[model samples]
Target: MSFTIGTREILAEPRPLPSKTVRYLVPVLSLIVGLMIGAVILLASGHDPIAAYKEVANRGFLGELPMIGTLVIATPLILTGLAAVVAFRMKIWNIGAEGQLIIGAVAASGVGLALGEHLPGWIVIVLSLLAGVAGGAFWAALAALPRAYLNTDEVISTLMLNFVALSIMNYLIFSSVSFWRDAERLTFPSGRFIADTAFLPRFWGRLHIGIFIAIGAAVLLWWILRSTKWGFEIEVTGDSGRAAAYAGIGVNRKIVSVLVVSGGLAGLAGGLEIGGVMHNLDPRALSLGVGFTGIVVAAVARLSPIGVILVAILVAGLNNSGVGLQTMGIPDDIVLLLEGIFFLCVVGGEWFLRNTIRIGVAGQPVGERSVP
Candidate 1:
């Protein structure tokens, strides 16, 4: 069956492969579309979109301090964005990066606090980062196990686990007198500060070695996905599970591995935040929706590892520009609206790129097309 677009029959047939140009153009077009839409919204709200955008640029990247702040914000976002990329590349909807990140912070903090007195600063830092990775991996396993073995819906499981992870973090710092909480603080609920040595070394103005770690991770991930056999199988599996099975690939194992790796990446972000920025497991400081934002970064970058870095920085800049928008008499919500618009446009553009539109005579028979 076909619908008519005016006098011609319209068909949206899945293509075997989208054009390379279209792949690149989709993002560019989406950005332009988002800007146009945002401009309209800004005009309607009696604000100058151009001035607001310029202010955003000035605040996010035009100066040294602003650039540093943007990088600081991008540190965690890069890790989380990479996490989303890993799971999403294999068509796994692992939405628990948020929880995984929190759990990672908890594990890193617990380990750092417990071992701080006995270990050297460098040792403590290493151990804390490892703990973060392990924590995130374990948390992801909670959802991955069911998905891999029981054929459960990972989307629901992962999303639910995010709440559980948040609750766990809250319980540690806010509700219970957990080890992660500072016992000395009698009035306010606060997390214990990590050992001084555990803090990630900074290069400039709060921009720590974590940015390097994030960049290194992106590079490593890019290499694995591009040059490794495992990556090839993941690509094949993502393209078609049945085809992957036919080729003797263990689809289930890949699911668990990819998800665990994804979680580990997210967890590493938490560890970095603790060591490089926060130096403590402050729930308020950590719950900035960084994990959720990573999903958008992943999608906008079209799941490219390196692209994730660029997108994360851009997205971080957008978020950082909220203050600038307020200065321009624009509500910070305008930034949110613009972000939402960009995300929607990118998602829609992706859909459009995947399907080819055909014009045919009414009642004409169309040949069968393979579904992507």
Candidate 2:
């Protein structure tokens, strides 16, 4: 009795890559759709859509001071956006940027206090920035470790860490005798003011130096991701761990590196918030929710470094107008609702781009064939 053997090979159908034009146009279209939806909601609720939108536009972008304020608020968002873009592009989830930012600000403040009046302005500024970067990196490394070694879900770890960071910041301001505590003022919670030497120099009277730093970071990230070997490895690792491993890329090391860099950028944003703008580490002041807002900015920008800048500005403008909407007889909560809509549209766009939807003919498993 002889048996005949047969061999066959199966190949996966290649997916067509979306064109660059579509890649850019989808986000723009999504934004338009989100705005239209928001307008419809506003009109249905008995609000004048045109007037409300006009007010939002005027307050958010038409005035000089308001525009400057928007940019000021956008600085941190831009940094956090970059942070999200960096980690997300490499398939690393770093939801703890808020905590990392707080820790960085605290650490930077400590460095500023330690230097006191004697330290040169240049040295203090440099040291404070470094301290911020180091602090954020340390905080993020904690999550990175479990993720790299044990395959823990970074989303859960990062989110939980945010609460821990907030607690630490709160402790420093209220309960702890840490360097950030304000001794002279006991009524209100406030951290010690960073010395002028450590403070970031203001530009154009309205804009802080942090804006420049954010722009520089955006450019650097763009260059690194496009021109560096490390960036290539990150992209490959993100696409497929098995493929990256086969290509000689150390997956764990890449994960650690990406998270650390991402956290560092986020920390820098916090440091700038204290040193450049706020000049003090107040817990309330730090809780602008910019870190979380950044997630939206990153998603809307499709995780592109350059796109982060524009998206951050758009979000910042919306946030600025949110305050003005209340004055115009519109509920401030509506602004938050608009933001939620924008986030949904952006995420939905990404999902649509990556998937195809099909309707079932008769409600049975759409793709399944019945055995006769």
The numbered model that scores best in lDDT is: 1
Displacement of the residue 176 alpha carbon in candidate 2, Å: 2.8
lDDT of each: 0.90, 0.84
Could you estimate the TM-score for every candidate?
0.91, 0.88
Off-target runs (Cα >4 Å) in candidate 1 are: 1-18, 355-372
For model 2, what is the C-alpha lDDT against the true structure? Answer: 0.84
- CA shift at 14, candidate 1, in angstroms? 5.5
Q: How close is candidate 1 to the true structure, as a TM-score?
A: 0.91
* Candidate 2 error regions (>4 Å): 1-15, 355-372
TM-score quality measure for candidate 2:
0.88
Residue pairs with backbone atoms closer than 3 Å in model 1 (clashes):
200-275
**Candidate 1 local lDDT, 196-217, one digit each (tens):** 8778888987789999999999
